[model samples]
Target chain A: MKSKGALQRAIAENAAGYFFLAPWLLGFLALTLYPMIMSLYYSLTQYDMLTEPVWIGMGNYIKMFTGDATYLKSLQVTFAYVFLAVPLKLGFALVVAGIMNQKLKLIGLYRTVYYIPTLLGGSVAIAMLWKRIFSSDGIVNAILRAVFHVNPPAWIASPKYALYTLVILTVWQFGSSMIIFLAGLKQVPDEYYEAASVDGAGKVRQFFSITVPCLTPVILFNLVMQLISAFQAFTQAFIISGGKGGPLDSTMFYTLYLYTKGFYYFEMGYASAMAWVLLAIIAVFTAVIFKTSDSWVTYGSGD
Target chain B: MSTLAKRRLYAALSHAIIIAFGVVMLYPILWLIISSLKPGTVIFSNPGLIPESVSLEHYVKGWAGVGRIHFSVFFINTFIVCAAVVAANIVSCSMAAYAFARLQFAMKALWFGVMMLSIMLPTHVTTIPRYVMFHSLGWVDSYLPLTIPKLLATDAFFVFLLVQFMRGIPKDLDESATLDGCGRVSIFFRVILPLSGPALVTTALFSFLWTWDDFFNQLLYLNTPAKYTIALGLRMFMDASGNSSWGPMLAMSVLSMTPCFLLFFSLQKYFVQGIATTGLKG
Candidate 1:
């Protein structure tokens, strides 16, 4: 009887566990899984939200590759933004982390001060703040005028400089990456540095040989994540361009273009195609990174 | 050179570098605060770090209405949505996490791997089809689309974090609890939930911040301005006027960021641990 009771209890426990996870499982099916499949189907069709989707295999893909000029432009702009922003942001973060890791007085205050921008970085408020600062008559231009006595260009209004404003905004939020780098720096053994000092290694040489090598995995992690995020950036570009992808479409990022196609034009099929193509691009890049990571990434066991 | 003198020089140089970057980092925010205090024309005419005099008129104007749009209603709606999301994430994620961590289940590893894949799939890829699905279900312009997802373990990052923490807990506790004649539910409620406080807090805080800052999803799901969250509401503030009002807009922007700032300070310890572990491991 006891054995039977135990068996029944085990079944009951499994049932309860399933019940607890039901909501998430249901959501995955209805929301995520179904939508993912439907998007694949939509990519082959011509959908305009209002009318039923019309099947047109390979046409949307062809247009994106060949016929669409904005798609190519957005791709190039997004690539430039990703490559420029990710490396520069990570470099700044590493420097800040190194400086803060020193045994300085009021270290906590410095961390807090550095992290403040990250908390506000993605907000509409910051975007508005960016708009004002980069505007023709804003403080930055005012400083330029006072210092050089020359007219400053409208940062956001001018197509040539709009994306750079975004790059600056991204670099300003290096606090998140900086905090991560600080954590990694804490994990480095002090004895290694002590030994390096005995070997008469300068600070720069110690950093290059010991510090950089130890921090490579963390750096790789930061790089991959930042690259993915930069490619998918939408909010900054959207707000700066006034949600129009404007100023000669210079700020038309990949995701913004996808949004415009999907929502603004209601070309759901074409948008779905664009999304899939983007997924393919990101997947290839991510796979390449993962493949190369094995060559350099040192795990805890150094395997 | 004396060692003390060299130390002083280095300290001064470091401080100078930090202070210079600090100004660059903080000047825009300081300017936003001052700009919000200024009147519309003064914001453009006198763009400096500090305002000559502060005025509450912009706050009043932003709070009340920009023409016909009421910012207060949007604020209330955002609060409701965020609160609901926080509550759901805490309850559902903890429960699901307990199972994934302690309970012996078939194909558990496989299921966990699948959950990880969801994290890599850019959410934008799924937005349109999800919109269509919600529209077909008549959930558009409703809170259901936003709130209901949190009840599921759809947030793989939170689930992964919880599972990692759970693994660190000793399994002997589970066996001992079972010897005490406590059933699985009792063990989970009594043994697991109490010990999992920090992990639970971390998950809850992230949910609050992410949902609060979410714009794309909010913009896609919500139709009417009255249903907008703070993120969407702030965007609407920018788009409301044909001509932008920097002063009032910046003021409203500052107000919108307050909750997140307050939450971060109140829960700084958990926030730091959470970001360091999850973000750095990416």
Candidate 2:
């Protein structure tokens, strides 16, 4: 009887907790978990929205590897983009952040100016701006004609240069990563720098030893986040390429292609398979980073 | 040079470099604004910052929009969606965060872990099934698919952010509220909610901006020009005009970026603090 009473009390105590968590729990099941299961099931079949899913046991996955060349090209383009864009962006961000972190006048104003582009980078407007500015007769070409006396190709329209324009767009919006790095830099104690200087260390040496070691955690975090986002890059490529991934498919981002297949072609099953592959790629990359993080990432005492 | 002189020189050099980069960084936006004000005929010919002749013709044309649907409709639609999303995220995320931070639920650890993992899970993995589910429910092309999921706290980023903030609040406040014969709900209303103002503001601001900037879901769900958000409206304008309407497009582009600029300038403090805390802690 006492045990039964205790059980009742426990239930009453925990009831409010469950009540508070109800919305999120329900959402997780409906929007996230259930959808994930259904997506997986769809991946193994052939289906369009108009008809019932016909079982096809790994056909879409097999086709991705063996049958389609555009799929292969998209994979290449996306991987190239991720590798190039992530490093250039992070490097540029770190450099700017180091400058921004300095004790200088009007630093806040400079930070704001630098950050404005990142605020609008994801918009269709900026992508449109990028597309025009890199066109054959646009501002960039006009400037090249006057200054260098040499003709420049229409960067966005050229297959060789199209992907780089996208890369440049990604790198231009390095402000968010820079802001995060600046925050991390501020948390590093001045004492460490002072002590290093007192021990006859130069600025470069102090930076390499004290600052780099301290910032490895933030660097790791930024790397993983940037990597994931870069893989999923869509808006710029989509808008700039006129939603077709044209110029000989040089800028066919993985997400854009997935969007094309799922929405435009209405190949639901194939899109589902592509989505699963994307998930696996992201998971593997993340896991690899986490596994390797022990060598480079150093947690502070509070952490 | 003397030590003081050397320090001053270094500071000046740093300032110069920052200013130079700042100019390069802001050049495209400046060009866009300047190009928008130029007369439609000479916008491409005079690709310089200084306009040969100024006019508001493009702004007028852009605001008139393509067909009979004005830019005002898109603006209203976007604002409605943003407002709904912000309110929903704040309410739903805060409640779940309060539970995780203070309440002693069974399976709390498991739930918290799942929430964190969900933060990393890409939306693409589930986009297809969710799209199908919403389609079957007859929510497509309406604001329901866009707004309803927010009510259930589908955005786990805000949930985790609020959880982190709530955890930092003094547990003694809850203890005292209980002492005053306050129940869990009353305690939440009277103490926790009021004290979590900054984090709540952070959540609201991001929710507002992200919803405004959202394109993928809006593109998928909103097909008709009548129901279009700003992003979709811009896309429609692009498709309708193609390369022939550069001046109007630039004008509309500048207008589309105005809200984010206003929010960033007005709430710089919260923006920086929110980013710092979230990035550093994560």
Using all chains and alpha carbons, the TM-scores for the candidates as numbered come to 0.95, 0.97
Put down candidate 2 lDDT per residue, A1-303, tens digits, no spaces: 999999986786599888889999999999999999999999999889889999999999999999989999999999999999999998888878877887888999999888888888888889989998888888888888999999799898999999999999999989888889999998898888888978989767876797778888999999998888899899899998999887999999999999999999999999999999999999999999999999989987633
lDDT of 2 at B95: 90
The list of candidate 1 runs beyond 4 A from truth reads: A1-13, A300-303, B2-5, B45-47, B242-244, B280-282
Clash pairs of candidate 2?
Answer: none
Candidate 1 lDDT tens digits, A157-248: 99999999999999889988988888898889888888997898877788778777888889888887887777888888888888887798
Q: To one decimal place, how large is model 2's interface RMSD in Å?
A: 2.2
Off by over 4 Å in 2: A1-9, A300-303, B280-282
Q: Output the number of the lDDT-best candidate.
A: 2
lDDT by residue for model 1 over B1-282, one digit each (tens)?
Answer: 996897688888878888887887887787777777776655653547666777887888788756467888878988899899889888877777787888766566777777778777787778899889888889999998998878876777887788778778888888999999987888888888888889889988888887877777787889987677778777777777744455567778888888988988888888778888878221
